[model samples]
Target: MISQDVGTRAISVQNVTKQFGFFNALSNISLDVAPGRFVSLLGPSGCGKTTLMRIIAGLDRQSTGRVVIAGKDLSLTPPHRRPVGLVFQRYALFPHMTVSQNVGFALSLQRVEKKKAANRIGELLEMVQLSAFADRPIDQLSGGQAQRVALARALAAGPPVLLLDEPMSALDLKLRQAMQLELRQLQRSIGATFLFVTHDQDEAMVMSDEIVLMNSGTIVQRGSPEEVYRQPRTLFSAKFLGEANIFTGSLRREGNKSLLQSDVVNVRFDVLGARDTGAGLVCVRPESITIEGASKEMFVGTEPNSVAGQVREAIFQGAFRRYLVQVGEQSIMVQQPVLAGTGDAFSQGDQVLLKWSDQAVAQIEDDTNG
Candidate 1:
């Protein structure tokens, strides 16, 4: 069992629901983010990720449920009263204020002493590596610099939990990647719990300790990046996380082996006992399927699992070659290292063998909800 710390609960959402007219933005969502842990709510648009974040920050109230932060029930806490810091996607810094003044804005609002606020501003600037730009106006800073200033301003109030709502989405690809690492390091240095929301799967996988995947006003799955990638509990999760080829097939058991019978292919595999129960969908990552050499094919028997495919298109992708192959009526994608083998250079119609390990196939539920 996972034990909760006795001191405080960082953030808890119990049976939360939110609606807008006839549309349900969020439906009975419950999640707990551990103290000092980085958790990300990840999903596509209209999945209610932003709605949940707004509720936590007190920017929007839930129709029904409880929000507890640091062991305090936030029933009446407004946005300003809650011990939370929010950094928005558009750096919302004051144009008229200098970097130092912006960072000290929260302290000034609370009637903190001038000398103490100055020291706090200096500390925050140093923390976000913006100490040298303290005197510069907000308009003069670059996108990354502006984001750092916004972060500094958010932390000025010494909030225990920080909420980032697509904070790096405005930057370019390279800058966004760099900022993800920097933000993760900053979170560790500050020792504060971070609840981040983003639609980018790569961003969530790169920065989060745990990820909550939502779709259609419900949470599809939640787990570590590796766990979700390796053994996805649902077909939606498997397809959403990365490239996967999903095939529906009937299952039959004989002795200790399981056979998946499809319309175009019949593959025999060995799975844990549950897979042998009935029909299900099989998910295979493109990288897991391989092209065999002439010598390798001699040792292995050609039957159910192995299928003949014709290369429909081959695109060179610098690091790898992506091949779109047609096997009967189904199209399967396979990727290989650019520098590997040359027995039969495949063209638009060249026949190739598609082989995969039985262990690579994962059984997912065939229901629409998955």
Candidate 2:
């Protein structure tokens, strides 16, 4: 029964729930996609991201609630009748059809004039940089070329919204990274609202204007990539979004700053409004930790945010050095940049101190703990 009559919405999903018998696939999902914005539905497998995307495309019906598109209630609308284009993981281009025919498939179905369709197809092929291969059969193109053809076909009709489901998963690593940049640039140039679905965190962070992270049939969190990454609201959001070093401890307040008291080490985590006593969790990102050789005057019990640990392993990555340190029962990871010819990298069995500002770590809210 939830609805949004605020700004113009390209896609409005209101209190939509989907169930297969007793198993709920999506529970009370409600989301708004503004017109001509690129948003991504990101989550792990079986997180209902795909199911929700299908509901928006009219391929699956919700058990309850409504869907409105561009001021029209399209809950009962069929898939082909909706003004949305779709692209799948596989290219799904016709084996017997040439690039031109495949790109112009929707246009031909609408019975647009022959010369006009060819001209429009030519423009799309040029846009995707596949004009040279327009006359070639689908079987003759490379994997990247085939993907470009599929993208051009989806954009051929100029649909107001485009739904993509892991469209770059099939490509190799280098190609996938390249396509990520290209697709983001293409979305900006064409000005079409894109609702993308993917499991890769890097891909979602790179291209999305806003990311909707779903978990176990519910929306866990939704915000810009930096907001969700830097200030995670929940423990699940902190761990699932990126690599996190978790600390289970107690929370206390000291004047303007909050402190996370743990058995391993105590740090000043500036959290707010929670009880000053109880078990809690503190999350520190790997890149935020700074590792240095421990001096004689190391941190005592009263240091603000510092700890001493023994280096268990140190690996040399190209641009940075990765160190694994053991402090009591916790394993801390620190990534330090390799300055040119400094030779200051630590090795195994070396004692190091972990130091970071209070702004680097956060106290995560844990509602799952009973």
Candidate 3:
């Protein structure tokens, strides 16, 4: 249970578990989402992100526990009866209907007044920047346009919460990126709680106000994007979110500070606690490491939090360069910005000294099974 309850919760799933015969897809998942916040369920496929979303949306019933939306318990409620909207990856627009008609489909079914429905449809189309394409057939709309139509339709009935299942997965890279920002902006402007599910880490980082990272049918971690990225709690969180350089060492105390002792390198950090002692693992992100040319007279082993290494591979990644540095038996990655006049880039086979601050080294549990 990861309770994100700060104020009023727009969506809450309490001890919800779903099982398919012998298989447990979601194991005792509990989450709370604040009102008007864009929360993303981020994890790899088969991690049960989509299944959790389905349970919250009333598309699937939980084997145990309850589902609450806006103070209402809807554990056994059907999809239509729940006050939630759904948008799928495939757009799911009607090819036979025009954009306006599709957007108004929910309104018509609800028997909203004709003039009121038209006004709502126009506003939704305008909100998604597709008012000009209102009369266009779904088949004639481009991929991005069709996606907007689907969003507008979902928003037509004005559901308090929206559950989107990898809605931008079908688009190309650039379009997908563009839609991520657009969707985030739309969520903020409308002030509706959005529960989004996606396998793409970038998508979750870009669009979410809070990222609920799930794995193996349980919530691994949940926090702001920067919080999750900077201070990962477990080995899986560190490796799954981004590239991590992992080290195994024994914890030793020097005065009030704690140090990680290893054969290849030694790391210094603030004292964690009594439970953090003994054999443990720590992770350092690639960008946290700084690299410089090693001097012949410099003794790298004597320097604190520094290691001597030879560059094994240098990768040019437009804005920055990624270098894989070989230190004894292990490889450490170092990333540096491409400054035009700096002439500081290291090449393959170059001898370098890698260093990082003690604050950058984070202790993590090696939860391999998760």
Cα lDDT tens digits, model 3, 220-258, are 999999889888899999999989999888988878777
| Poorest lDDT segment (10 consecutive residues) of candidate 1 | 292-301
For residue 15, what is the lDDT in candidate 3?
A: 94
For model 1, residues 176-262, the per-residue Cα lDDT tens digits are 999999999999998999999999999999999999999888888888987777677788888888888777778888677777788
Superposing all C-alpha atoms, what RMSD in Å does each candidate have to the true structure? 3.3, 1.9, 2.3
Clash count, predicted structure 2: 0
Q: Which structure among the candidates has the greatest TM-score? A: 3
Winner by lDDT: 3
Pairs with backbone N, CA or C atoms under 3 Å apart (clashes), candidate 1: none
> What lDDT score is found at residue 354 in candidate 2?
90
Better of 2 and 3 by lDDT: 3
Q: Name the runs in model 1 displaced over 4 angstroms.
A: 1-8, 254-257, 267-270, 273-275, 293-305, 339-347, 367-370
- Which of 1 and 2 is the better model by TM-score? 2
- The whole-model C-alpha lDDT of candidate 2 against the native structure comes to 0.87
TM-score result, candidate 3: 0.96
Model 1 lDDT, full chain set: 0.85
Q: RMSD in Å for candidate 2, one decimal?
A: 1.9
